[model samples]
Every structure is written in C-alpha cells, then in structure tokens.
Target: MQNFLNLCNAVIGEDYVLHEPAKQAPYLQDWRQRATGQCLAVLRPANTEQVAQLVKLCAEYQVPIVPQGGNTGLVLGSIPDQSGTAVVMSLQRLNKIREIDTANSTITVDAGCLLEAIQIAAEQADFLFPLSLASEGSCTIGGNLSTNAGGTAVLRYGNTRELCLGLEVVTADGDIWHGLRGLRKDNSGYDLRDLLIGAEGTLGIITGAVLKLYPKPISQGTAFIAINSIVQAVALLHLAKQQCHANLTGFELINQLSLELVHQHFPQYQRIFQQARRFYVLLELSTYDNEQVTKQLLEHLITTAIEHGLVEDAVVANSIAQAKNCWALRESISAAQAKEGKNIKHDISIPISQIPNFVQDTDAALQLAFPASRMVTFGHLGDGNLHYNVSPPCGTDQDSFLEHHAEINRIVHDKTDQFGGSISAEHGIGTLKKQELLRYKSPVEIKLMRAIKQALDPHNIMNPGKIL
Candidate 1:
C-alpha cells in the first residue's frame, strides 16, 4: 500500500492523492448512507492520461479500482468494499467543456462536469441538453451515463443513453478509446458507446462524451390536475398526449400521501387545486411559439380531460413564477420524505399501458403485507417509472423499520417482474441492488454480463463486485 501511494504521488503529485482518513471518508460512503467501506486512498486524476496511468498501475499490482463521480449514487456502485484494497478514483478534476457545435447540435464535455453545468452550457449556446434529475446539481455526467439515468424529461428527450452521441473511455488495460463523434447517423458494426453507457463502470471508465442537444423551447406551460386514482392519472396522460401531441413534454403522477407530505413539510406551497383528489398529475407543455399558445393548449387539454372524467379539477400556471413554484412541489418530494422519516425507495418501471394495473396491484399487495407502513408513490408517469417508497409507521424505531427492507424489496420487485418491469428503473444496480440483480436476472443474462466483465476487465480491477 505504501509503495502504491508513492507511485500515485509521483504520478499525480501529493496534492492529488488523499491518504488521510478524514479526506477519504466522504468518498467511501454512498448517498443512501447504507454502505461504508475502507480504501487505501482516493486519487484525483486531472485528465484522461492520468486516469489511464492510474488504472495501469493498479492493474499491474492486481489492486481493485473503483471509479467514482459526484459520489451521489443511491446504490453503493461508487463506494469501495470492506476489503480496503481498492483505490477510489475521483473524476471531479477532469471537468471541462471541450466543445459545443451548434451546427451539429452536440456538446462535448468532460465526464466530471455536473449534469446541471452541461445544461447551463447548452442553454448559453442557445440550445438545450434535456437530461435532468433531482440530483442534477451534484450528479456528474459520467455517473449519469454509467447509470443511464432517466428523468422527467425522458418523455421528450429520452434517457442518458439516448442523449449520448459518443464517448471517450479509458479501457481496463489502460488503452484510451476515443470515439467522440457528432454524427447523426453512424452505421458502425457495433455500438461500443452504448455498451459503456449503462455498464456502471464495470467495463471501462468514461472520461468524456459528446451529448445531443435540442432547440430551447420558446414557451413553457405547467398544470397541476387532481384525479380520482392511478387509473384516472393514466387516462389523463393518454388524453394529454392525444391533445398536446409532441408538446406534451412531461406527465408525472403524485399520490395524495406524497402531496400531503410535501404540504406538511413545506407549508408555504399548499395544494394548487381548489379541491383535493386521490391523486394528481403534474403535466408540462413546451413549444417554439412565445405567444399564448402554450397556455391555451394547456387549458384546452385540461378542459378536455375534465369533460372526459379524467381530471376532477386543474390549475394552470399563469406566469413563469407560478410555473417554477409548481415545479418546486414536484422536486421537493425526495427531500420532504427525508425530513419526514426513513423511506424505503424503489425506482421501478413497467410498460406504459400496464402502469395503471401495476400501480393498483402493487399498492394493494404492499398494504396487505406491511399494514403499518405508509406509502408515498410518485414519478414520471409518461415514462412508466415510479418512485414507490414506504415510510415507517409513526414511532417505529429506525433500525427496526429498516430491518424489513428485504421484505419490502421482495414484495415490490416480485410484482414488478411479474409485470415484465424492471426492479431498477433509473437507478443502477449498485451494491444496494446487486443481490436483487442476481435474483431477478436470468442465468443466461447473468452469464452474458459476466462474460462481458471478464472480456473488458480480466483482472477485475474496474469497480469490482459492482453490477455483476
């Protein structure tokens, strides 16, 4: 370990290597605080060459290496293991915007750049990079690519995998793969960029990428609609899609429990509708026209939905300020839940057509199995993903409450599989869902994954024991 530290220092200087426990502590734990591990040191590589050198040295020594970005992952994918034999490589220093070609509608950025930063850069260039999330302020683009993160804008722009045009990666053997091209159509034999997009760093370390950009919407409109149930919410989604067509940028479902929690935690932003319903749909519309077309379209859609019995009541944002306020409510769900109590979160997804049935059946099953639990279900209804979470009953001990995590996961995941859905919709199967992946994935699928891992990282040096 001492020799390895000396080599790292000699290669990247002493300031870049953090050997002290205090300095390395934050990188060792994930965002969930569920897994804490020990590491020999945390290396801050400044560029792709430095990353390649570090990987080569680690591989030569047969030492495990964990590539981390932002350290905001819910799963322990970015966290090292208990062995204390791994080196946590932080890509935060490699952040740089290499290029923004408005003609080609592509933005090339370093992996360490924050997702929000990329969005802002695109906006400054009169374009839009629409991959957004609650963690955009902190989550790195590399992490988003590694997990293929899905966000509310997926209905319009698709997930991280679809947003990426190309990637520049450092292979396990210290060879750099520079495939960053901004072509709209590439008839290559195999799409290697897609392979590493959601590999969670098991295949290679993503150093940078060329991401797709879109035209900035000249007009935006938002609405908060109250509905009877998940069934009505799905119906409302179809109605909005039919009425608004491509302008329908987002359609999210929020349950009463989730809204009430937000209201209780954030009293300033109360319900926007005049009357409360069993569920709510937060819909957004965007267009290139700066006229009142957005507002008119929203009102028309809401009126149609009401007439069709899809929505009980609705409120459309009158101004930009109101639209931002409406978005705040949707964005505050995770924080509000954290303030309320310990939550068991599941990011699951199913076919859009079967979402109504899945939600109804899962809610019933969860209520029966955990009578003392309070469920707060919400997420991107347009994309068929939900952040199905459960809050412990009042006065339940935190440790005891969390002990039922396995049981809760089994119930939710089993039903998701039955519906041909994924146990992990957006969040990658880090250490948190690694065991679940083994359980839910078929033997053939697992074998293929293992074969890919062995092919890319024969020595198991790149993020060992993760996503395998």
Candidate 2:
C-alpha cells in the first residue's frame, strides 16, 4: 500500500495525493450524508494525462478506484466502502472549458466543470445550455452525465445523455479513449459513448465531454396553476401541450403538502395563490416570438383551461423577477423536505397517462399501511419523472420511521414495477439501489449488464459495487 501511495504521489505532485484523515474527510461521504465511507487516499489529478497515470498505477497494484465528481451523488456510488481498500480519484482540478464550437452548437468541457459555469459560458457565447437543476451551483457535469441526470428542462432538452455528443474516458486497464467528437451522426458501430454514460463510473472514468447547445429563446413565460387533483393536472398538461406546442418547456406538479413544507421552511417565498388546492402546476413556455406574443398565448391557454374546468385558478408571471420567484418555489421543495427531516426518497417514472392512477393507488396503499405519513410528491410532469418522497407521521421519530425503509421501498417500487415504470428515473443505481435493480430487471437483462461490466472492467475495479 505504501509503495502504491508513493507511486501516486510521484505521478501527481505529493500535494495532490491526500492521505491524511482530515484532508480525505469530505470525499468520504455522500451528498445526502446517508453514508460515510473510508478510503486509503483521495487522489486529485489536474488533467486527463495525470488521471491515466494514476489509474495505471492503481491497476498495477490491484487497488480499487472510485471516480468522484463534486461528491454530490445521492447514492453511495462516488464514495469508497468501509473496507478502506479503494482510493477516490477526485476530478476537481480538471476544471476547464476546452472549446466552444458555435457552428457545431457544442461545447467541450472537462469533467469537473460546474454545471452553472457551463450554463454561463454558453450564455456568454449567445447560446443556451438548458440543463437546470436545483444543485446546479454545486454539482459537476461529470456527475450529471454519469448519472444521466434529468432536470426541469428535460421536457424540452432531454437528459444529460441526450445532450452529450462524445466522451473522453479512462478505461479500467488505464488506457485513455479519446472519443470526444462533436458529430451528430456516426453510424459506424456500437456507441461506446452511450455505454460509458450513465454507467455510474463502472465501465470507465469520464474525463471530458462534448455537450450540445441551443439558441436562446426570444421570449419566456412562467405560470403557477391551482388544480383539484392529479387527474386534472394531467389533463391540464395535455391542454397546455396542445396550445403551447413545442414552446411548452416545463410542467412541474407539486402536491399541497410539498407547497406547505416550502412555506413552513422558507417563508420568504410568497405563495402565488391565496387559497391552496390539492395540487399545483408550475408551467413554463419558451418561444422564438416576442414577449407580448408569449404573454398573449399564455393568457389564452389559461383561459381555455379554466373554461374547460381543468384549472381552478392560475397566476402568470408578469416580469422576469416574478418568473424567477415562481421557479424558486418549485426548486425549494427538496431543501424544505430536508429541513423538515430525513425521509425515504423515490425518483420513479411512469407513462404520463398512467401517472394520475398510479399516484392515487400508491397514495392510498401507503396511507392504509402507514397512516399520517406525509407524501411530498412533486417532479417534472412533462417528462413523467416524479420525486415521490415520504416523511414520517407527525411527531414520529425520524430514525424510527426510517427503520421501515425497506418496507416503504417495497411498497413504492413494487407499484412502480406494476405500472411498468422505472424504479430509478434520473438517479443511477449506486449501492443504494443495486438490489432493487436486480429485483426489477429480468434475468436476461441482468445477465447482459453483468456481461458488459465484465468485458469493460474485467478486474471489477471501476466503481465495483455500482449499477450492475
């Protein structure tokens, strides 16, 4: 172990190799603080070349490697295990924007670049990178791609996988694959780029990527609507799509309890509606037309929905500041839930048509089993992903309530499977969801996944206990 450490220190400067407990503390835990791991060391490489060299040394010594980015993953994918046999390879120092090709409508960036930084760079170039997340200020692009993260803009821009054109990766055997080509069409053979993506760093370590960009919208509109039920919300979504067409970029569904939690924890964010309804939809539209045209279209859509009895009441943002404040309410749900207490979180997705029924059935089943358990349900309605979470009954002990984690997960995930929905929508299967993945996937599917893992990482050293 000492010999391996010496070699790592030699490849990257001694200062970059963090072996002290104090120095390695932050990288040893997950974003949610659900679990803390122990590592032999935390290695920070400045560039792709140094990463390759460190990986080669790790391969030579048979030491496991955990490729981490910002350490912001909810699952325990980016951290090492309690065995303390693995080393965390932090990509923090590899922060750079390699190039921006306006003609190709792509930006090549290092793995460690912050998501917000990339968005700002794209805006400066007079283009739009529409990958917006609540954690945009902290999370890195590498983590986003590795998890194939889905945010609000997924309805229009799609997930990180769809946004990426190519990737530069370091294989398990310590060989660099320079596959960063910003080509929209390449039908030569199997797509290695897509394989490495969303693999949770099990196949290879993503070092860099070429990401797609878009022209900025000429006009934007945001609205908050109060609805009677999930059924009505779904109907309103259909109506909005018909009226706004491709201009409808976002449609988020927020249950009453989620809004109450936000109000309770963050009183600064004023509510848009005076009276609360069972559910709320934070919808947005972006178009190439002017602001007046956008406003007129939104007013027309709202009027039509109200006439159809789909919307009880709605408030459209009259200014940019108002639109931002409307978004702030939607973005504050997760944090409010955290401030309330620890809870079981499920990032599931079902067919859009089945969502209303699925929620009704699941909510009833859960209430019957665990009475008074708060359901903080909300997510990207347009794309069919829901962050369906459960807080303990009022006055119940958070840790004690968590003792029913396995049972709660079973209730939710089984229904998800029954509805033909994915157990994990945006989040990848780290150690947290590995068993669930096994139970949900068929024998043939699991076998194929394992075969690919074996072929790409024969040594079982690239994030060994992740997705597969």
Output the number of the TM-score-best candidate.
2
State the RMSD for candidate 2: 0.7
**TM-score of candidate 2 against the unseen true structure:** 0.99
Off by over 4 Å in 1: none
CA lDDT of every candidate: 0.90, 0.94
List pairs with backbone clashes in candidate 2: none
lDDT per residue as tens, model 2, 356-427: 988999999999999999999999999999999999999999999999999999999999999989999998
Total clashes for model 2: 0
As for model 1, its CA RMSD to the true structure in angstroms is 1.1
What TM-score against the true fold does each predicted structure earn? 0.98, 0.99
TM-score of 1: 0.98
Candidate 1 worst ten-residue window by lDDT: 269-278
Model 2 segments beyond 4 Å from truth? none
Evaluated against the true structure, the overall lDDT of model 2 is 0.94
Which pairs of residues clash in candidate 1, taking residues 3 or more apart in a chain or in different chains? none
- Reference-based lDDT, residue 20, model 2: 90
